[model samples]
Target: MPSVMEMKPLATFFVSHGSPRTLVDETPTTEFYKKIGEYARREGIQGIVWMAAHWETPYDTIEVSSNPNPDKDFVAFVPDEILDWYRSYKINSSPALADRCCGMLKDAGFNASLNSTAIWHQDVMIPLRWMYPDSSTCPPMSLISVNGRFDPYFHLKVGQTLRSLRKEKILLIGTGGGIHNLYTLSWHHIIYYKDTTPRTKPIENFAAAFRESMNESVVRNEGGPGLGRAMCRLLKHPHFLKCNPTPEHFLPMVYAAGGCTSYEDEGSVNAFGGENWEMNTQLNSNFVFGLPKDDTIFLGEGS
Candidate 1:
């Protein structure tokens, strides 16, 4: 295998997977993630390294799936059929790759190491496994979470550690949302309405602000303090309290952004889907940071 430094540039994504109940819904979010799988196939991604909100550790650790039965059923959210397929296929869980990522992080003036067990079960993995059932093209790297808190420095270090992997033809995905506060959403309002005319103004406004900040980040190419400020505003949005009671959902995006050498060099950063896809889900925002100017198909329509 090539050195981590030689890996291809990685694409970072900040997606929102609304209500675990949404998983069973045949809506735009499901379609969006499916389309993302297609996009990954076209891009020829060797494997994916995901930072999921569902997974967190008491300490900073990177888990290297080394189960003798690497395919054992670990994620309960996925169907049994998918789990069986994952178990049967012998995907490459390269220890060398994991080591290199950890080493790179340590070399970059940060503390890092690897673990052999999964820290959490990510919802996105469900669609990802379905998209590449063969397992030949969808190997993954699991990062252990540090408590439930969203530690920017720790995540930034994780991204920096994985920097070498990007050049090695791997894709680094930061799976979460820009503004998520489940407490408020689950209690304050409803995401879906019967009439749809008098839509939830609070949610709509929140999504708009989130998109505006993301767009501004892409345009400015170096959002620095502006990004932090925008994120604060997003967190304060009423919907945030309902969508994400904790910061875990929102922090992954920040860490993912910090990993990039520059926004101008990052690949397409966009959301998948969740509620009111046509109205609120900014799926068409093909915002690219650090991606080639000629790459127009970065974000594809839902299948």
Candidate 2:
């Protein structure tokens, strides 16, 4: 019989890390991150490979966090107890995982490089560090946005390369929001003060549309045309310019999902409880390209 990690199918996820405010809010988004970390601990994952929007590369290079002492300042505001819990856990940042992904891509006739100079200490990872402080030490891999252009075929190719790493029991995580138009949304004002203005309606609509599209992608088991169409519609949405001024942040999730063979719900949590309220949600969205019964990892009960 295969080992537990080997037995479990490879998983992929596209999580909404919300804005930086999530680190300090008593809202749903913060709760969502907490729930996700708890679920991961329960799932018995050896380690997670994060593909975060915060760690963008300038070209086609893949940047791997090879820092001997990865930055921990991202979670400076986290409670001591939470910080201790993470410090006590034995988490490994799998730099080797990054190498594996790069190798796979190179063997498949794709030009890929491993970059270690990139900094990922921004919106997404900062909040993630707070939520999963114990796992913060885990190795992360990043793909740079090619001058703001999104090539679906190239992304799919990267996903295909990532498929090989899943067999080794790495949980691949793609972090970013479905709608990430920071400048236009005025992320600071809305997530903090609870703005109910009608202007924000477009943001809500975009979020709802994103959720629907994700659910559809999971249920349908294929994202090629359907997913692309939904994304295109989002880009054309009137408020698109405000919510996602650029596609770089939004595209990472797509690449993460495209790499998976199958997806499973680990858990879902809601952070706030008001109309037009900010929703910082987390889901143990698991993915496996196409591994047989060789995949079955459970991470605690679903919320």
Candidate 3:
């Protein structure tokens, strides 16, 4: 097999893993991930470098493990069915790639270190489990921690530091809710919403307005750039706290954004999961920064 260093650069993704309930459904979002996996195989991703918002340590960290399995935390929050689905997945990790990532980050001047820890957040496990289906088939995976500080500039800088790994075909995936604030949305929307048919609640509304603003900010086009503006509006957004009670969920975007080829590098924006967290705050939205094999396709799956 060709080593990761031998392969070409792979794209980075901003994956939205909404409530755990969505994992069992066969939805567009889930199909989007399957196609993404197919795309990754075509690109020869040596291993996965997953940067998750759910896992945060004071210092930048990476997990080194061979044949890893995801840890199901907070299983009691959901139904037995959800827990059963979560328990069915066994994702693998890569120790070699973890070491390489640590070396690269340290050389790049970031406070990087390695641990033999079993770190699996819903953000990391749910998407991959649904996307790959078969755990062993996954490439060697390494876990990267979100910094304690939710500074966009800092995370972006951290992403920039790891850009070199792309040459090794290491995939950088940022997993968390783009509009992640479970506290605001109605529980009925979350617990009751099924994957098929028209959603009981409209995809738009107060939740969508914020998602729209986020959409405009990230998707580059003739309308011009919005990263600068988006960053500014985030704090200003009336539901900013409701959308993001804490920084862990939203910080990954800054890191993902920082790692893109350029601010102008075009990506796709996907808005789903209408379950409003608080005051019409929707835990929806995801983006990707990379060259798509199909120019017409956004993140290998069009919105």
Candidate 4:
């Protein structure tokens, strides 16, 4: 068998893991999640390094969730039954990978710490349950906390530090929405609308502007550092605040973009299909970067 480092490189993904309910909701976003799961299985993924919007720590340090079986941190405002159901989902973690991740971050001058008892948040579990439904057979995984200070570039550097993991067939996934404004969400629409059809209509005004800007930056044929820098600039975008009332959700995408810094081809960064708008407040435009050239067909699956 080929050595782990000798294995063909796999892509890094930026997934917009919608709501906690997405686990049960059969929306377009969930469909894409299933497709990505197929893509990962076909690619022979061995491990996962998940950067979750829900797992944010202080700016001075980064925490790597090291628990062998991390517990779920239930989301608020949901029905009690849903929370009970969510508790049943579990993830088998990779302690070796977690330690390796911590060492790598520290070597890169980051204040990396190991979190032996971190709680798994919806941002991490929702997409995992959808993509890798069988937790028992799912790849060994671990979570990396985003900087609580919500510094885009800081997260980018963190991604850059872990870029080498892709060569080992370990998927790096950053789960956060492209457009997340809970205050603006259509609560009534979400409650009354039962149709599972994916929202494909083009978003207007500030949402459109922000999404376009993000796509342009990601597709630019540049090094990891350049892409990371380009993505960091979005924090200053006029529509940024409108799209992301809080920085947590938006910061993970920067980490995803930063992970792509290792690839230089114009097509290194490709958007996944199934762009969906939820409650007119969340936009799920997922991306896969550093894909092998021969696997262009996989690109057709999402973008």
Candidate 5:
């Protein structure tokens, strides 16, 4: 007899919610998100289970935001325009859905909770709003807070814990930068990241190299057993540090990566933005683990 899990149909995704300006700027990454939105529309994704680099809890357990109104998180008000822009958008949440997710995780033996204290960071807002545009059409959403260790395996397990929901048409998205080297951020012109018309900034060579290597491992690697092997190889690879100065941002990918059963196909990766001091190398590359229904091209939702 097949267990309930074997009957589910679901796919997981990893999306990069780079700088706050991602929505306002014209970039390939944002365009890529629109593509994802189109895919979601056709697939009829019921809701989203997503996490942002901004939220982290010291506790070892996982948390689901049960609040329908997540706080407009982020305190940097230096650029009044940025703050105002972030607050202008009225973002809503789904307490019922969030509680459901927390229940699922807890059932899986994961330390999970339904949190009323959850705040919606722009990391969740920007990309989602850009993709769905119309808030009403956007699926019921819940936010996950990262644990203290930022353990890749733990996050992966956290994602795996929710695998059952995939069949229910819920979309699992992990939002964060592909490479987060905060020490090198161009804080001087932080507000005008997109103003660089011609030349973009430079990121460490090793950063880009590591990201490429990871892409190859996750996307091109073959065999079910090969997945673990590839991860081992990449983690020990020389580019690890250059790719992630601190592991929090990269942890989201680990969560997203865990969604695949094995040999999941990766969609087109759109690497963009080099304006920050981290330069061209601090690219926010994104990946999708499951194949789209029919792999149809073009934009917008279906009839």
Candidate 6:
């Protein structure tokens, strides 16, 4: 592992893992994931602290994984071959860092605890696999869960609590969809299959609107308190319920936004991906916050 001083500073990221299919598909979102991996390797990121939409603790309590070697747990319907491919590699973790995260949350007046038996769900693994194909070279990860209550403000506060981790050369990531309405997505898939069978669903007006609103919110706002305030407003967006029937998936974005804040208030935000919408309802939007404005490594031609 490289020392912290030898590595370039990292920004907090919110990446859309789409589905387990991302592992095999060569879509724009997956390509963005590959770029993130390339950047991490080039910058020598020391570790990763992740928050995912899939794992949520009950009530106001937040759980952190202290397991040195966690097991696999996937939510999407991945085929046997894909599952086999995923299991072929070993992902590592850091119990010491996990404990430290729990401490930070508890000090902030939140009920937080450690679970040594925590499992690595697809939400946590899929992006990691894509970002670091070689598990052995992957940074040591520490998984944290969002509150089941799904209060956007609460998760934002949690991210703010851990923002200091960025100075440690740790990359904080939130993995969830920009627009995730499974019901609408299922119907769209059925409709498309009857026509010319396409891999992705047709983009809906409401979905596109929601995606644009989200992108604007991230790009227009600065990191930290202002960004957190902007993210909280997303809950009140006209298409919020339509795009996100539940708060679990969308809350991770708020969490990631909170950690993007910096002490000097100079953190920059870049909408690194989201050129394609998946399942019609999901805009695979991803963002990186706290990078310098002149840093062009993660920015694309128009970004």
The candidate that achieves the highest TM-score relative to the unseen native structure: 6
lDDT string, candidate 6, 1-303, tens digits: 667445445678888877666666667777777777887877677888899788889978899999998888754455577677688768779998898999999999998999999888887777876788778888888999977485787898888888877778788888887877787665544343322124454577887787778888888876556777778999999999988888888888888888875454455655656555555555677887767777666665765
Candidate 1 structure quality by residue, lDDT tens digits, 1-303: 756555446555545544433334445445556655775777777666666666565554434333322333344333466446544655555565566655666677654556665433434544454356565566554443433453455565565556556555576666665545433343222233322112343446656666565556544553233333343455555655444466676666555554464443434343323333322332222222334434444433431
What lDDT score goes with residue 213 in model 5? 85
- Cα-based lDDT for every prediction: 0.49, 0.48, 0.61, 0.77, 0.65, 0.77
Give the Cα error of residue 92 in candidate 1, in Å.
5.6
The residue ranges of model 4 lying beyond 4 angstroms of the native Cα positions read 1-6, 75-85, 191-204, 220-224, 263-267
What tens-digit string does per-residue lDDT give for candidate 4 at 14-53? Answer: 8888865576666767777787798888878889998998
TM-score of each: 0.66, 0.64, 0.77, 0.88, 0.82, 0.89
Q: Give model 2's TM-score versus the native structure.
A: 0.64
How do the residues 113-138 of candidate 5 rate in per-residue lDDT, one tens digit apiece? 88897778877777875687766677
Better of 2 and 6 by lDDT: 6
> Candidate 1, residue 155: CA error in Å?
2.1
Which of 2 and 4 is the better model by TM-score?
4
Question: Candidate 1, after superposition: displacement of residue 183 in Å?
Answer: 1.9
Q: Whole-model lDDT, candidate 6? A: 0.77
Clashing pairs in 5: 201-274, 201-279, 201-280, 202-278, 202-279, 203-278, 203-279
Model 5 TM-score relative to the real fold: 0.82
Candidates' RMSD to native:
6.0, 6.8, 4.8, 3.0, 4.9, 3.3
Error of 5 at 46 (Å): 1.0
On the 0 to 100 scale, the lDDT of residue 142 in model 2 is 34
Error of 6 at 260 (Å): 1.6
